[model samples]
Target: MDESWASTIAQVVSQEYPAAMHHVQHGPGHADPRELHPAFWGSYDWHSCVHMLCSAVKLHGRDSDLGLSALLDQRLTPYNIAAEADYLREHPLYERPYGWAWAMQLVKVCRDTRWEDALAPLEAQLEHNIAAWLRTQQWPVRHGVHSNSALALLLIFDASPRMRPLVERTALDWFGAERAYPHEWEVSGHDFVSNGLAEAALMRRVLPESEFDAWLQDFFAPEAYTFYTAPIQVNDPEDGQQAHLIGLMLTRAWLLREIGKPDGTQQLIDAAAAHLTGTNFMATHWLITYALLAEDALGN
Candidate 1:
């Protein structure tokens, strides 16, 4: 793996985040995760953009640079400042006192910088979010991916000492449950890639690595992809349209890479890049992640 690949993507993702946030302003001064540039609107849609930005910045190695630290400071504050006053009291439908992006950005930033000072307030919000998650018995929480993904981060965060056990228990419960709400829509009878990746990462963090390894094989089985509905053929020449396919393919590809299967990983990356290139949905976050992964595959 090219170590610099992570940094390159980090820079590209960082460059776009501020502009993407600018387009989605929701409240008096808040940005909506929905509205992006016209052409890139479908390409880098709101949720995808936010997810990609969070994921890319979370890439582990690049967080220590003073330059990157300053960039994060620029985007993190005012990006969230607009909602500070009303965050808990009168936030939007999906907006929360502790949003998935907010938590993700904070935790990831904390991974490298003593920016521990910057994250002090965010730690309180994460604590609140944990309580909010535990208090509910609802299968799929109010927000779409936000709740599950945010919960996953509670454990992923290196700083959350108290949260480790709770996240472990919650993840095990989700995995052991007889039925799930299905995060994957393309698959008629399956969950989405976003959900798969979230749960997979959670399992890896909470369980023994060997057990996690077994689960990865079962989830990425070829038969499972065939049964999947929407993203069955991500790069089907017939329709030649469908950006969401990248999410499913890349998730599986990344899973392979995690286990050190470079061959399988590169195949999926190639397929996803073919679909994304020159597509209108270029602005989506999945594409960004895909691009970074592809760059890595190319030894960039």
Candidate 2:
């Protein structure tokens, strides 16, 4: 939220435009990510790059910082973003729900910014793709990982009221029946999001307050959810796989705030803050976006 954090995020999202490109080149001619995805070819992957760009839009909208403004102007141009849309059109299910969700969030956050028009092409593409996916996909990917449907739908639910009805219907059908979550079985080593927590967070947005309270009680089974009371620790921050747990702490903090678990939110935020020092590229490449999410949700 400060100039220092802005600088760090700018550095991470822009530093390696062509490095670590995670593209599944399906019968490709040229495998270069910069030419392929000129707008979102950074921050390791498409979704991370998108959410970080979302952060840029939000920061610029808030403070009108000249650096962030310049970044937005450079990357969020109609020419570059339409190229991103063109790429997505070629690969319809490229990022599927996760990256699509962040793409929508990016546009949603850019509503009042100057970049809104630039993102519209991609936004329209995602609208058609995600809507079709929501209607046809019968199952939710209820994992604490990139493919998780609940968290992505949760992001979509917040990104627009136009998509809310579809998101709510699909979310209820997929996750409404979930109960008796085995809290201990949650959070695989490389997971950054908690499947159980993301489901609850989505349901909270869809269900009424009293219904959600009852659903929460049934989902956790009286007192089985103390696992998240403390922040998850990453034993090896340098390991790319283990580094995901750093994001887990930050995401859990915001979702905790969403589900009215204030007692644990501070603990998670405090524990996750130490890793945002810009020292570890494994953590810094994408964790600041989630840290900003926690900071906003906690009103800090």
Candidate number of the best TM-score? 2
| After superposition, candidate 1 runs with Cα above 4 Å error | 1-71, 78-102, 114-116, 140-161, 177-201, 209-241, 256-263, 274-286, 290-300
Top-lDDT candidate index: 2
What is the Cα-based lDDT of residue 130 in candidate 2?
A: 91
lDDT of 1 at 35: 25
Q: Tell me which residue pairs clash in candidate 2.
A: none
Q: Tens digit of lDDT per residue, candidate 2, span 172-272?
A: 88878888888878768799998888899899999999999999989986454467866776889989789889888888888877888767577777887
Residue 182 of model 1 has an lDDT of 39
lDDT of 2 at 20: 62
Candidate 2 lDDT at 54 equals 87
TM accuracy, model 1: 0.58
